[model samples]
Target: MIYLDDLLAATEGRRVGPSAPARFPAFCYNSRRLRPGELFVAVKTEGGDGHDYVADAVQGGAGGVLCQSPPTNPTVPCVVVPDTQLALFNWAAYALRKYDPQVVGVTGSTGKTDACQAIAAVLSTRHTVFRNPPGLS
Candidate 1:
């Protein structure tokens, strides 16, 4: 689990609330999909700023919020980074390293599912394998 304070320290961001300790097992963006103990990364976009959704995310049981700027609300712990997308990618890379799963990179203009299935079929014979469902690409 990742602690909210540690995440703030890692990003050197300002805390908005009481600074109480909180932990989360995963990170997410969509408020609707946030779990009870998940960190929500609020991404600012051209269409609308994610900061507006911080309150909603917190209400949905997000343990923490990651953003490029401090949110107006002061009830939830917020981690401010230079860039939300970069921070998300960095956090994902760190988490993936901790899991240490076999990484398979696939890129194609067509038939990506077929290729992945073929690879999974071959790899499953010798090693425990997990593949994304077809059409997920």
Candidate 2:
């Protein structure tokens, strides 16, 4: 679960719309798959703008939204940030820190995923490591 206060601090977002829940069960980018109590992320992807589906997501029972803008006459709580996508990433980083305080990031032009896997393998022997690589589903 994600707490509203932590989410706001992580994304540097402000609340809009109605009073929000203290926590969100999870988050979803697609309205079709959004579950009740989940936070819907309004991302402006190349395929489509998630903002267009806020109503549908609300109707589907979304608890709140992490978006660049709040829907007009909004029915649910909204966390408005400068960039929705960046906010989501920030939320992920914040959540990970909440679990383990200690975090290690591997960055480079190439072989980043491989490096992560290798690092996880080495660390897992002594400490549990959570490694998420690109393209992971």
Candidate 3:
């Protein structure tokens, strides 16, 4: 779980509304899938504005909202940041800090998939391997 104070320190965003939970179980960008005690990040996507889902997120029992603009008369704690996307990145970085893991990046104009697979195969001999497939966010 991630604490509200830790999120506040990592994002450096202004808080609005009532007191937040001691900690959140997870983070989510989609209000529809958000669970209770999860932090919801309002990301403006080409599909639609995430701000439009703030009420849904709150009603879904989101513990907090990381928003670029304040939610309309927010009832849950809302952290107002300059950019919600950047705040998301910051929050992810903060969450990753709890673990010490070596990361390998594979990039090339050709044979990128083969190269990544080969690297993972080699690394798996000594360490657990987790390869992130392309086009995943």
Candidate 4:
């Protein structure tokens, strides 16, 4: 679980609305799938603005929201950030820091999968390596 204080520090965001909840068990981007006690992240995607779904998420029992724009007369706690997507990445990075594990990032236009497999194989010999590539559901 993540405390509101820690989340505010991680994303460098300010809380707007009622006081934040004590903690959240998960972070979510979609209101339809959001579970109770989960923090919703309102991202502005090409398809639609997640800000539009904030009410839906709250009604669905979201604990809080990370958003670029503060919702008017907000009911739940909301964190106002400069960019929601960047805030998401910041949260991920901050969460990873708690584990104190060495991070290895493999990025390239091509050969990423092959590199990941080879790196995972090598790392597995010395550490319990876990690989989560993008596009995994």
Error of 3 at 23 (Å): 1.2
lDDT (CA) for every model shown? Answer: 0.73, 0.84, 0.80, 0.83
Better of 1 and 4 by lDDT: 4
Give one digit per residue, the lDDT tens place, for model 2 in 46-84: 899999999999999999998888898888889999999
Cα-lDDT of candidate 4: 0.83
Query: On a 0 to 1 TM-score scale, where does candidate 4 land against the true structure?
Result: 0.71
Q: Residues 1-137, candidate 4: write the lDDT tens digits.
A: 66787778889999999886868887788899899988898989899999999999999999999899988888888999999989877877886886577778887788778888888899999896656443321
Candidate 1 accuracy as TM-score: 0.63
- Model 4, residue 24: what's the lDDT? 83
From the highest TM-score down, the ranking of the candidates is: 2, 4, 3, 1
Per-model TM-score, in order, reads: 0.63, 0.72, 0.69, 0.71
Q: Tell me the lDDT of model 2 at 130.
A: 50
User: Each candidate's root-mean-square deviation in Å?
Assistant: 5.0, 4.8, 5.1, 5.0
Off by over 4 Å in 1: 1-6, 18-21, 95-101, 110-137
| Local accuracy of candidate 1 as per-residue lDDT tens digits, 1-137 | 66675566455566666565477777777787788867788887888777788888888887778887776665667777888888766654664666678889789899898999899999999997645546654
**Which structure is stronger by TM-score: 1 or 3?**
3
Q: Evaluate residue 95 in candidate 2 and report its C-alpha lDDT on the 0 to 100 scale.
A: 81
Q: How well is each residue in 18-50 modelled by candidate 3, as lDDT tens digits? A: 765667777778898888988888899888889
